[model samples]
Target: MTGFIVPGSPEWLRLITPSKVPAILGVSRFKSQFTLWHEMAGSVAPAPVSERQQDDYDYGHAAEAAAAEYWKWKHAGWRLSRGEVQLRNPSLPFAHLATIDRRASRGRSRRVVEVKTARDLYEYGDDGSGEVPADYAAQVLTQQLISGWHDDADLVVWPQYGMPRIYKVPFNEAVAAAIVARCAAWVESLRAGTPPNLDDSITCYETVRALHPDIDDVEIEIDEGLAVDYLELDARRKEIEAAARGAKTKVLDAMGRARVAVVGDVKVADRRAGKHSIALYPATKNLSQIQEHAA
Candidate 1:
């Protein structure tokens, strides 16, 4: 009772997966709901994966095996199984899919084991606390709902510099139900050709730009209030930048003849040499005149 369709395939794009749950709920850091809507509606194509991004994806997949082995070694009694297994619920009105990383079983109890490779534990909580990022929690919760394994799931996160930690995630019926409802509505919106409202996230901004790449020479008047707000924000931003540059100048002046600055045990800043030379002073009209002419 498992699916054989590969992820990211044309067919897979038609169904709502656990990974897309976060986007629908507006908790995903990488993508906004608007962006997801456009992608699912086939109005805009997904961004092309970069070389470095592909390498990271490959590394994460390879790390999952090591994480699985670590999980087995850490819990000797539990049995773990992993494969290209996909699950779904035909009883649901909308198409939803889940491809879990691993499944752990002990006696009659079953747990979904999700392996994540992170550069740090900033988004996750203490070991065994069941606390993870909202997006990650949504993903696992959706998995539990689809697989019908409501037992406490194991989220094994392997940090780049530390030992792998296991966080227990217990499924909540209310949350899972909300996720399904929202997802169903989202799917209906897709079918009705109603896109989600745009948000302030960079993903949404980029998606909007990508969707309308060609610009018309015709000018259109926007809201005057919006224009005023943007101008005010831009002016404030320039002020902040100038103040930051002044502070940096003072710090560099204080650290003259020293490559690094420190206070007690805390290292402050390191002025290292780079390919491009750093300009200590701003290139103002007077500074430009001094540079062009003799002192």
Candidate 2:
């Protein structure tokens, strides 16, 4: 039997509803759970992604489809094919928290499974030991917790450039409890009508910018420490700007009339003519302005 996708299914509803325990506690490499909190509470509008990222997301779904087939055909233990999973438990503060890729059993031993795709296996590697990234680990943990299967779950890591590997994760009640606690605190903040604090990461900065694209200058004095810090940052930025102009001048002089200068990954190309002369990719320049909007 083939596993079917339930895109508009009830489970999918829970998946998108947010405040998910895994996402709240999960840490991506950037160490930003603040993004998840704001997104979950519906504070920020959806951010735009590149076509390449969209393709990767599509690839992940495709890999999941293939995984369902692999388990059913290759693993004798695989039983009753399924698609979307609704991990629900009334005992939990949140009714639903996560979804599993494909669930199977080895004869009578049933297990929930997560199908994940990555470009490199090394992304999850740690100290020569094959350790799943903490975010994924926390995700599977939440999936198992909500599934009521406890320690019964497996993670299928399908590398785009390497063979697929499976790892079994046992339930960690302490970790699960910690996740629940953090989630509860976050939910409380949401209910209290307080916005979550975001880090100084560019991701957060971009998100803020997207949320508030308009600018009408209105100044309000910030805290003394923060004001001093900003002034220091501005001073350094000016210094960098001056240095950057001089550096570019030197490079341009060396280039003379060369079309492109190749220094490792850094590319300095002539801009007087040709298709490359016109900028194909335009990026937002960082600007310092009074952002009067705050929740």
Candidate 3:
């Protein structure tokens, strides 16, 4: 919103703004970074969200609010920031900024706390020590640089069920420095007005499609490098598919009519649900039977 990016917003993660640094910068290294850049640079329209994803997005906000209230009531000396913070250092990237979630402070010591919902807290290594996933670490570290707290932060993760987990990540100056340098480079790219390099991710494909759904009615020459790679990859994919089909056929033949065939605790039979989901080949009624029925 405005020239600054609101923390935790899709636009914030996707683009570089005066108030927030780009999370998809060099630190994250997700293939979707380029896809995010396209969104940030306004080269492509915003991605269309499906119904299920839209529902998740809506509920995520509600969950965050509930967690904020719970945290405020649960812990003593746990206080929340009244408003959000926007930080854009002159030494950092141009027209880009950093924003943080609720800054939770206890006495004179303050730390940033990011509320998260996860199916598994173990992934972040909820051992009180901050051994978080790389992406999550990058997110809060960038926030730290923007917020100027220069202290540790907390990742409060609530699983869909079971108890919540809290991981305390100390302020990582080394990580922060690298992130700042990377953000500066990304800002240069933004000023230069070019999309980041393309990758094989569906995000890149979809972004292209979203920007140019229809092709112009002109036959133009194009580079053959990608075309050659595509042809080879496509052929290899089909070959692998065929090999898979042959392997499955062998397994089915070994099973005959038996439901599940196993060898040394390894299974190679139908793995779907339902009583009739044995996944064997189906036989069709004979043409003679059809004629007889008609008569």
Candidate achieving the largest TM-score: 1
* TM-score per candidate, chains pooled: 0.80, 0.67, 0.67
Worst 10 residues of 1 by lDDT: 279-288
Report the lDDT tens digits of candidate 1 across residue range 1-295. Answer: 6448777877887789998999999999789999999988888888888998898789889989999999999888998886545788876779878888998899988889998887545434332234687888999999999989998888899877567888878899999889988998999899899998988999999999999999799999999999999999999999999998888889789989676555543344556554496434321223334444544
Give the per-residue lDDT of model 3 (tens digit) for 1-295: 2465654366554545422333455334333667667767777766666897688666766667666776677667678876455666556544556565577887887777777775445333343234676677777776676667777777777666557666666778887887767766776777798667776777677877887778788997768997898899999999999997997778677776675554433333333333565554221223344345557
lDDT for each candidate structure: 0.81, 0.61, 0.63
Candidate 2, superposed: residue stretches over 4 Å from native: 1-23, 69-75, 106-108, 124-127, 231-295
lDDT of 2 by residue, 170-207 (tens): 88899878877776677677778676577776667777
Q: Could you say which candidate leads in lDDT?
A: 1
Question: What is the TM-score of candidate 2?
Answer: 0.67
Native-to-model Cα distance after best TM-score fit, residue 23 in candidate 3, in Å? 5.0
The Cα error of candidate 2 at residue 65, in Å, is 3.2
Ranking by lDDT: 1, 3, 2
